[model samples]
Target: MKWITHLEGGPKRVNHAAVIVGHKIYTFGGYCTGENSREYTSMDVHVLNTITFRWMKHPISDLNYYENDDILPFKRYGHTAVVYKDKVYIWGGRNDRSSCSNLFCFNTTWHCWTATKTSGDIPLARDGHTAVVWKNYMYIFGGFEEESDSFTNAVFSLNLETMRWTYIQTTGKIHAYIID
Candidate 1:
């Protein structure tokens, strides 16, 4: 693969969640390393337009509201994202202090974030996981669980329609714990 160079104004981040919607590639929160080599999680959204090959930062709205209400998800890294319809759903990630179990959605059309309410067997707070959407469900698999202090290969699925999570049982020898 060839690297695209001179793409200025793009975010330099790691463990971020990225998804393609139309011709734009949307990237959400991750750890940003600065000139001093200090790293910190950023609550920012960057978008790359494939046609123009340019990056643009999307500003967050209602910053004041976020402080008063739980409207936005915290700055996170090692999260997983999937695009379903017009919105991108992000789940599983952590900042400096702790991991997260809440699911947040970024509306591409509206350019806003929403804390989605979910029910059923919500998986444990985790990071470094992967997610994909199939049919009407979003499947999340494997991540590092801080409470257990170990890697997990557990699989869970969230139904987009009902906003319910279900633990999926796996079969065969493919089941294995994650390793660093």
Candidate 2:
């Protein structure tokens, strides 16, 4: 494995979500806790070019608005992001303060962020959840919920075409974690 180096000019974060589209890795939401002491929950977008081995800041908006005029998502970690077609879907992550279940979408084609409205039984607020994309659906399972001091065993599915959510009930292979 090759160690990725020289990402110093961009955001320094941990627990950030990263997904690759084409030849680039798009990183989202991470906390910087060392000397910089920065919290990057609802911050900016950064890109790492795998081919060139360089890091660059990406614009997360269209040409219509400036940073002072647009609204974005909150800062979070342990969130999951998946790329399907031309869009990147961002869901559930928590920061030092709170957890949220809101869904945000960044259009790679348009270079804009759009808040998504989901239907059906929405999952509870969580972090560290694992999300996987298969075909046209996104499957989400288990995460740590700080408010209850417990881990989750629930499964949720989101339809990419319809933008709807559904809680799936299963009897086996339920995702869970142990707390001490």
**Best prediction by lDDT:** 1
lDDT of 1 by residue, 20-107 (tens): 9999999887877652222232367889999999998887722543463465777778999899999999998988788989888889
Report the C-alpha displacement of residue 151, candidate 2, in angstroms: 0.8
TM per prediction? 0.87, 0.81
Candidate 2 local Cα displacement, residue 93, angstroms = 0.3
Candidate lDDT (C-alpha), each: 0.85, 0.78
Which regions of candidate 2 fall more than 4 Å away from where they truly are?
1-10, 34-41, 61-71, 173-180
TM-score of 1: 0.87
Q: Residue 135 deviation, candidate 1, in Å?
A: 0.7
How far is 105's C-alpha from truth in model 1 (Å)? 0.6
